[model samples]
Target chain A: MRPDWIAVDWGTSRLRAWAMGAEGVLAEAQSAEGMARLDEGGFEIALLRLIWPWLDEGQAVPVVICGMAGARRGWHEAPYRMLPCAPVDPQSLVPVAAEDARISVRIVPGLAQSRPADVMRGEETQIAGALAVLGDFDGVICLPGTHSKWVQVSASEVVSFRSFLTGELFALLSEQSVLRQGLVGEGWDADVFLAAVSDGMSHPQKLGSKLFALRAEGLLQDLPPASARARLSGLLIGLELVGARSYWLGQPVVLVADEGLAERYAAALAAQGVQARLLPARACTLGGLAAAIGQLTTAVSGTGRKA
Target chain B: MRPDWIAVDWGTSRLRAWAMGAEGVLAEAQSAEGMARLDEGGFEIALLRLIWPWLDEGQAVPVVICGMAGARRGWHEAPYRMLPCAPVDPQSLVPVAAEDARISVRIVPGLAQSRPADVMRGEETQIAGALAVLGDFDGVICLPGTHSKWVQVSASEVVSFRSFLTGELFALLSEQSVLRQGLVGEGWDADVFLAAVSDGMSHPQKLGSKLFALRAEGLLQDLPPASARARLSGLLIGLELVGARSYWLGQPVVLVADEGLAERYAAALAAQGVQARLLPARACTLGGLAAAIGQLTTAVSGTGRKA
Candidate 1:
């Protein structure tokens, strides 16, 4: 189906797009041609290949893109917008010079913090989308993924945020480190996970020793692969939760993630007496792009300011 | 010079051999033919390739071996000896069926703990060496390497010990993880490292976020590669020191490592008001093997028992 505008979430490893009309998304498309797989000259070709069917013969359809596509190494650098600001500002939209006039592309700028030195790309768009759907969120927004972000929002502005390498560390250790042998195959024990979470939270400093314990347990007591994998995940996530304690403690938490990961997070948080409202990641991404588009339209009409 | 016996330190990634006379080492050789690169049958070949020159035509020289050569996946399963025992025991040594009648090889069994589920193959040999050199010592021994170990020794016996993935984590994060880009080049900042060590000790739970800060700082503040690498090293070591606090606090610490790594650990401990004496790792391995040989000799004469 033909659309008025397009929503593109271009991350490091994957690319997703949605065909948008006056009412809502009319069609969806995706590809593995993410920012990491493309060079400066390859972005236009990749985008054209994906959304060519949806573009009109003469009209230049506005393509709103978010995530790593705006990174310094992406299509074109969209400099990070310092935090204590709106997630997506219409004035900060970086327009691209597409070879094909049928598609006009603009990228969303990521948010950066100075003190603790933190940054986010596509997650900012998700934050904007989540805020749009939630209406007024003045607490914490937790986006769990490879590089998890815990954003503190106040009056529709992102006050501050911290990024944790929990998911990334888990993958590296379980797949590439010495722990790989014992962590092969996947069967999960929920009880083992929760216990490990408690251990991780209580003794986070002993992470190195705790990690080595998985292999030691496997060798000494014949700990199952599934249990070891579960323990590994719990230890990393438990440490992440400890790091993000300041962000979520005494604050309403909204988790932006999919079903499986969100459920694990919810369980981890629930054990700590915090109830998190789960929101699907895809909806938030689409919503964020829609919000950015609305602001862009308003600014072009001479009604909206920079923010 | 002809050797009375041979001492071999066969670890996961490297193999070192010393031709030992009555007084000390006569000639030494090393190769990358570690346990990881050799199977059961291959170990004999690798060992012979390194120390064949030290062997004579008829006499079968006693060859004492330590480290991963005794591991389950190593040359032959020497089987881990349960802890609350001496680092290396004479009776527990597993004699290997070497093809060369010129040399009689025996692998030193590693140590294992049940409750914490920790295991060590080579470090136990180092501890034996350290103890042999510093007689009547009852304190903590810290052996820092790929898997850094902290051992509590009492009356010449290993009461208990723990192994941390500190060195391995440092290698993985600095060389393979996302932080690799920011840590490419050989440079170091001692002050930056000390400060990171302090931070790691105080907030070891915040490791995930602190690690991400290295990348963020590089992007936003142009943090030098040298400083980033130093910071990464400090952070991991600092976390390790914190985890091994119970082993070192109010106890004498003997660090079995080479100069550079030992100095870092010493400085890290000094910051926490603990004084650690540095000992050369090679000397420890040789001494440990020598001690094992002495015990075996004494036992053969029916003077010394199993220990």
Candidate 2:
């Protein structure tokens, strides 16, 4: 089957590419050479290494890339499109001229807000994909990962959004901070997590003190590792929820994440008496990239315009 | 000059020792071998390495140690004393048996609070030292460091206290987070810092968003390094102040730190309309240990009890 184009999520640590035909995914490939590890002129080679088997001798393959590849220090700087705009705009695509004609690459621009001063690169792609799942949806879409983003989508456009350092904070606390002593476990305590969410929402100011308490609790009372880990995670996530109440309160929420992470968010929201629907994992980023490509294809095929 | 006893401040990263006599004239020494580095049976050797010159052969000299040396994993497991107690109890000192008969060692116990589940190892000494300067200060004492502590002292007893990770957060965010890009300076911005402090105190939940803004503001608006650094510090400290409102709302605040750090806290508190008086650096730690020793001296000399 002849492929139309490849959708790529090129993040900081890794890259995943899917060769999509007119029907569906023809082939999928990935690589460890993410944007962070590759230097100037390395991106083209890295992309080719993974998808070389899928390319033809003379044909050009459209590869739409999102995430860190669009960062200033990445392959090419795709300037951010400010918020209160369409999640994916055809005008925002930044083209990267590939040395090999077999690779035609374009990177999607990220989103930025001015007043609160927040930015999102890859998560915006997921936001675009979100619109595909729920056409004309008006609500909050939360994409949780290393950097969790709570986006407000209304009328097929992102009115505003906030990025929380919750995931990073949880990772840092569990691995690097004093809390590491008692947080080495895969087990979790749901009760502790829910209670923690209540505490965090009620007394947002007690966050710093609560963080230290995890370590103290472990030391003074020999808190179980599972409880310690769960408490630490719940505390941070709860802190984020308290901060992001404006985004989800009385608003429909659509969580976009893998099953585990999304369920975590759903449970957290449930604890707060809020119902949040979940979108299939990786649907948003892929759908978002595909949606963006659809616009380019339309512009290119219907009229002579930049794709 | 020969000293009466040696007062040592041993912490996670370094060790500082002072040879104290009845009079003021004495000697001081320091070493990089803090409690964190040494393994089992390494504490005695590390101590002697720094303070060996002060010892008289075969004559046992009383040595008082404070800080992390009393941590459960430190030189010896010096149990933490529960709060609503004296800063340092004579009975709470854990005696460390030294191979060298010339070195008679006593380690001070740290303070712990139960309700909020918090603990402090070294700051209690600083609290005691504060009492030395401001006799019977019935107010709050702010000890700003890696883990800043806001203590409530009344009638010469530590009634209650709270620990804030403000200093640690500043170090991590400035050196490890994305904000580090715009925080490589020794500059200060009074207005920006004051505004950020106000925001932090007024809306503590905005911490997650405000943190991301440091990086975004740098990328979009070309924010200055000094202002970025100042804003980050001010925000964390302000959030802590917000949580610790019960300690310093209308009560007096005594800032105990080195001139520069103390001045930072003083400035931050002044922005909140709270006047914080500054104390000489390290005086509290030394005085707190001295005060505790006075209790032992009175017990041994007057009551013929454990010295």
Candidate 3:
């Protein structure tokens, strides 16, 4: 039986599922239930609700799931596959067997680094997608998201990567810290933000102590919240830039992210005199999955195996 | 009437009031609550309570206040006099007339920067003391406290200075933010703290973002909380170092602070390759107030008047 759907990317806080026809043409798409909404019911029930609208009366659709859905706490625990190798194909994907379910669902395992003991659930697909699109670009590919991943891709494979909690740090600081008192009502000051970045770069040693100065200087001197927020942002981003620099110094870097994050990275790169371009994350994910599927189909044909 | 005794010193958290004899011997020492505690009671009441104990036994001892007690919300709100000027003396201090009491009191105002509108309530006294002792040292003097002040002293005149909010940031970030989760059981990791300082100094741009990385990385990689806390401390101190470098770049620096704060500054300065000597804040404040008083008395006597 030929499957109607091709891929699905389910992550913490969000979910995305795409449908493809026999020729890899995106026939139709449907999404309703998000991963954040699913808690009690298992993956089978959740996946069914998401794809039920696009399903025919009696058609069995094979769906491949990636991201947090593959984590230990997700629908089913898909084991981690280390780096220096290609991502597993859809057919070779791990199956979640339910005693009372009829639909077949496969989940992709996440990747882990032994030395750092770091594990990533959704970034692997994005890296795989980046590799598929770039063909064989060496150096580091930074995937910035809620948890930003700095992956080192060499020889067409993800050699190693370090995850910097940049986004989460921003969220925590902006919304939670005393620095929150210094944030403006709406919009951000690019000039202030950039200046803060410069300040961070120039006085990296004073980074830790200077944070309080924001409040002291701003409060005593009455610096505007927008400027304070910008400084806070600059301070955090500056720290991340330093860590990321150590990993990919003088290397051609490709940032895989959405538009907003891409712009932020671009600004940061410009400050450091490094050029970076943003590659659409979803497109790369699709391309990478397609490549994985193509490899699997070719292998099956070469082995003369029956479906 | 000559006061029985004079007690004076500027503290970070609180202003110290003293009951002294004509010989300036310590008769009785009392803390008039704390600067942090003054936010609620309106400065007048806070000041009265500090000297209330000394006013017992039907003796109305004339009281003099220096430090934060001289700020806008303080007792009389003495205006800040800029640098290249002598500290305002108790005799020449601004008098706050009590509407319903016979006890006379005066409040000494702090110095302010006109452009930035930055003001220091208690630091001026310490600066005066540093001047009294050194008389002519052309170097940067750092007064480390809750609101640490880094002032440039040149031949008995303050050229320029900047304040860093290092201590407060540490308090807020460690106790308030989600980073608290990572710092729950961890005491203090000097190595981690120092490493964080280096990391902060190297990449000031990313300092702000690196905070949340503590928790996220901990959850994903299980980084110890003590290490996270140390990183936080290091980050803050590193930032301070960055800011302080400009002021203390090539010149010698004298760090005037209490024992605990002095040690912290010493560690941070040593890490940044800057030489610093920790002078007790209490002694400096006393010395500063004494010098200011001596100058004020001389000015009054020379003008054929008495305070």
Candidate 4:
């Protein structure tokens, strides 16, 4: 009997589910009632609702979950795997038996950094996807988002990665700080932002001292808020550039992000004389999940489990 | 009749009061509560407690207040004065006639920047003191504190000034941000801080970019938190230096601050190629109050009022 699969990526604010057939083609896709909306008990009910339309007559399909859903506070704790592991490593997948016999669930484990006490729940999949796409290129891959990840990939394995809390800083500065008061009704200016980006990359050492000049210059000579916001964005991105540069020396960088963010990264990278390419994040995530599932299937089959 | 005099400097955090005799010599000094501790009814009661000791000694003193007490939400709404007005300008002083008895009160007005909608409540006194000391000079005077001020003085008058929220930013970043997680202790390295300060001033444009680098560099390479704090301090102070330079133009600067802040400014100024003299804040405040009082007394006497 061929097994039907449901793939779910549950994140901080949203939940996305995809139904895949044996051939790994997207049969049906549904997203609803975000992760934020579901409680522990509600997870099963929500999952059922999402995959209900994909279920054939008298057939109960198994589901695989990744991202924050497998977190300790999620539906079930998917124990994290330490470094020196591949995306296709079967040892990293945690099979969780659901209370109901009709439903089978498997969760992908997160990655942990012991020294800093930091962990990433969902980005491991993206890293896996990047590794799968690169096929054993040793270089740096930056996944930019709310919490940016700079992962070092070697021999198709994620050696290690560090997360920078850049987005949170931007949010706090733009929304909470005194800069926010001055930034009311401001919009993004690409020119100003890029200029700041170049300036930041050129002088990574003086970052702290330069921030106060924003308010002082603005008040004294009436600097536009848009420029201030752009300058702020440039500053954060520039700092990230310096940190990322330290890990991977003079090598090509692959940035995995959406179009807007990719553009920003491209500009920042160009400023630092580094070659960078934008990789589609969604495509990489899907590819990563497929690779993980393929590995799990092979492992189970080798163990003489029914296919 | 010889008029009993009261001097008050109501700053952002504290309210200090000094009772003066008929000859304008400080007879006794007292402090009750802080500006932050008072609400509506709290101010009057707090002020009475501060002056009650001197009042109990048979003194019917008329009080004069400067700083935040003159703000709209402060003790009473003392209206703002435009630029080029002395601190003791009789037309600028907001006098509040007591509802009962011979007790009278006067509040110094704050300055406002029309474009940025920013206002300074207390730095005017420091500017006044700097002017009283320097007599006549065209240069920038930096009053460093929680809300650091960079004022432009031209010919014994404050042309314009900008308030940089540098101290507040440092406090928030060090205490609230992810950088806080790394900061285990708090003894600053002046060398590290000065290096960062120099780096910041040289590349004032890159202020925003270097902040996130702190977390990334610290995490990936284990950069010390104390260094991070110093880096942040340097960034803010450097930015202030850049903004101040536009008004500074290599002119001799009077840095009015406490000892620690004075050191920081002295180092930052040295990097920026400016000669700065550290003026004790207490002395400056007292000198400014005295100058203001002298002007007010002369104005009242010129109007044929009994001394």
Candidate 5:
């Protein structure tokens, strides 16, 4: 099951790779050795460890990489392409000098916007994939994760975008802060979540004061761990929605995330009378990588590979 | 000089004690063995480690304790006294069983409000001390720390209060989050702090989005560590002020905090045309302890000790 090319998504905490042939994926591999764990020299070593079995005897396999692996401190610096431009450009792919003779690697540049000053790495590829699948996306695309991003698209180009630390805040507060004492289980309550979301959205200014309520309720009324966790999540997402109201208000919204997160976001939006289109994150990643591969095939004459 | 009794301010991180004579505090000592570090049996050992030298051969020394020392998990559970009541009542003090005959420890009961579900441990003593010295205070008293509290007072009773996790949020975001990469030093920019305060108060809803700007500015424009720290503090404090506007807007505010935190809160309030009267935190703690001591002296036939 040897492959002609490879698709890699190297992020902060984990790495995922796919071996590609003319038709579709032949094999897939992943590792916990993401960009954060790798130094400048560690990237090639980590990549070779996963894809060594797929390499041909003497042929160089073209590898298209996306995400933090292209960061300044990753395998090689792939400077971000300024936004108000297409999501991915094959001409801007930066090549890495790998010690292995069978490896030929090129990284997709991330997107950067000035003025308010923001940047995105792997999401650009995902957006490109979404555009590819949807034909042409005209509204906002939301990629929810540790750092959730809301992007505006027009005419196959990313117009503007904003990133929120809502997920990170929720994680820190629920796991590390005083609130951690109350949020202890995997139990969840949708009713409590929706109530908290409404509270957070309507009175965003009271966030600081409201956080302590979880702890107080646990001590006074014996609030359950699941309810506390749900409330904490709802509060942060609700606050995020208030900040991103301009992006989704009166506009078509699409969420690129897994089932659980997608359902939570969809329900939150539904409360405000907004319906969002859902796309699986893994599909979008592959689609984006395939779109970039199409651009690479167009540039190189004898590759004989279809994207 | 031999002391008549002892005063204790035992909190989560540190424990402070004063050897009090009939006139005033003769000598003071502190230790890192706070309630968090000490188990049920460890509190007596920690307290004795600091005050052993002051104990006489046979006389039982009256020790008045405030703060987390009176918590349910502390050495002895001095249950919270419901609000609309006086801050300190020596008659309500819960006595602890100490192995040593020379020690007679009684913990001051903390304050609790039912409607909004709020609780205060050490701050009640501080309010008691502030009221003892001020004769009578009718406005709000702001005590800033890990959990900053805004207490409304009427006549000599605590009317109502609210607590904000602003200080805790600032610590977590500046030291543990991704923004920590940009905040490293103790150098603060007052102008930058003020501007961020304005931004936070004006658009409290955008807090989740605004936090990422500190990191973005650092990556794109080389924002200094001090400025990042200042901005983070200002933003959290500004948001707190918004939630607590009903307590401070057009109302007199008395801040019971150390010089550094008091100055920051005062500056933030000044930006909103509110001038807060500052009182040293230690003084308030001592004052509250002294007020409780007076009640103790009146209730018991004194060994010639005056509060």
Candidate 6:
């Protein structure tokens, strides 16, 4: 299939790109060279090395990027669209003029919340893609990762959302704190995890005490490393769920994240009697970026200008 | 003032010793050789190095040791005395024999609460010291540190306690987490701190979301580093107070910690309409150790058994 455009999900530490032909992806490429590593002038060079195989020699390839690559400090300054707005808007896309005419790129703008002062960059694209799958869905979307977000979407608009430091807390507690003394790097204990989750959901305020208990048990009762690790993960997740109860309770929920993280969130939600529809994180990003690409394609085709 | 005995507080990273004469401390010395850096036999060597100059030739100068030096993994296994018991029981002291007869050492046992599986080695001695000043007072004792503890004391007996990782969380969040990116660390914003404390106390369940907001506010609102730092500290401390409300509410409260930490706790308490009597940590430790030393002195004078 002949390539129609390109889709890129550029994050802080890593970047992924796909050559989207008329029907589907023709080729794909990835790199560790994300926004964190590259300066303003280096973005084009970095993109070309990965997407060169798909770009026509003279004609410019339309590239829609979604993530930190569009931040103020990133490749281009793509300002945030306020809440109650569409997840992905082609009109809001910030165009970046490259030295080479081989690529025409428009980076997706993120969403910003003022009262609580929260922001989302790459996840907005995922939300747009997930919305595509649900099609005019009025529900909640939960994306679990380093920073887990619970977003309430209504009529293709993000009504309100909250981000939790669940994953980061898990990482710090398991690897850096005294809790690390009892945790193994790998292995899972479902029983211990569930019990701890239940405990956290029941007594969320006692989280600090419970965290130290992981270490105390290790010293007093000789708790196994795997169980401790699982419990740590569970407790943190449970605390997140408790905090996020207002967002997902009695709402149609979608889990948009990687396989493992999605599964963990799904299981945790299941314990609370809430079943969520799981969507691949990649699919959501692709669908969201495709929506942006479609708008550009329609605008360019009608105006006799290439997208 | 000739030296009578030594009062030593041997903790994880630091050690302090005071040469107690008949009336008061004759001299004092300190070292970085804490229990964490020593092995089973290294304890005596470390202790001796700090108190060698105080010991009289061929006479065993009694030394009353407190803190982590009494932990099972510390110098010797000085087991915990169950709660609803005395804070520092001379009868419960774990004896330590020395190759050199110039010093006689006995470690003070810590207090343990079984229901919650909580343990404290050093703080118990602090509690004993605070109790000595309070004189059979029945109320709550708040010791803020790496592990901030709230103990319910009744008639000189430690009834029960809960330990919060408030200080640890503050250290980790301020220095290690993404929140660190926005903290100035030195200046204190009292208004920001109090407001955050109120916010945290009102909705303790939103701790995860609230924590992320600190970083978000930094990014979006360009929150000053000091205010961010103060707010972070306030939020965590407020969360702990909410959890520990059952201990301090409608009861006389005493803040037993270092001058700085105790003052902060006192301020937070005052925000909640609670005035806590501040107890200097050193005074408590010295007074507590002095009581233990007095016990040994009386026992030796009567039963002919050295400390």
1 or 2: which has the higher TM-score? 1
Q: In lDDT terms, which candidate is top?
A: 1
What's the TM for chain B in candidate 4? 0.85
Best prediction by DockQ: 5
Cα deviation of A93, candidate 4, in Å: 8.4
DockQ of 5: 0.81
Task: Residues B138-247, candidate 4: write the lDDT tens digits.
Answer: 78788887677777777676777666667877777777775676566767877878888877767654443355567555654677877877888887787666656665
For residue B16, model 2's alpha carbon misses the true position, in angstroms, by 1.8
> lDDT per residue, candidate 1, B1-307, as tens digits?
5788999999888999999998798999999999878887899999899998887787789998998888888888888999799999988889998888998989999999998899998899999999988899999999999999999999999999999999889988987787999999887898888998998989999999999999999999999998999999999998998898899999999999998899888888898898888899999999999989989889889998645
Per-prediction TM-score:
0.95, 0.93, 0.66, 0.65, 0.94, 0.87
- Those runs of model 4 whose alpha carbons end farther than 4 Å from true positions after fitting are A1-125, A129-166, A174-176, A179-307, B1-4, B20-42, B56-60, B97-103, B113-118, B203-209, B216-225, B303-307
A27: Cα error in model 3, Å: 17
In DockQ, how does model 3 score against the reference complex? 0.25
What digit string (tens of lDDT, one per residue) describes model 4 on residues A23-127? Answer: 665654556665556777777777777666666545456676778787655777886676766644554678776655566788888776554345677788877
Candidate 6, A1-307: lDDT as tens digits: 3478899999877889998987787888999998878998888899888888886666787889999888877998898888988888777789999987888889999998897789888899999889878897999999998789999999789888999998888877777776676886568888888888888888887888888777777767788898988888888888899999999899999999899888888999998999999999998999999988887667667742221
Taking the tens digit of each residue's C-alpha lDDT, what string does model 2 give over A41-70?
898889889988888876888899999998
Can you give the lDDT of residue B16 in candidate 2? Answer: 92
Chain B TM, per prediction:
0.97, 0.94, 0.83, 0.85, 0.96, 0.93
Docking class of 5: high
Could you tell me the C-alpha RMSD of candidate 2 in Å? Answer: 2.6
Worst lDDT 10-window in candidate 2 chain B: B298-307
The better-scoring model by DockQ among 4 and 5 is: 5
Worst 10 residues of 6 chain B by lDDT: B298-307
The residue-by-residue lDDT of candidate 5 on B138-248, one tens digit each, is: 999999989999999998889899999998998889878888989987788999898888888989999988898887778778899989889998889989999999999
After superposing candidate 1 on the true structure, give the runs of residues whose Cα lies further than 4 Å from its correct spot: A21-31, A45-57, B52-56, B100-102
| Candidate 2 TM-score to native | 0.93
lDDT, model 3: 0.67
Stretches off by above 4 angstroms in model 6 are: A1-8, A12-64, A72-76, A95-106, A302-307, B1-6, B19-64, B72-75, B95-106, B301-307
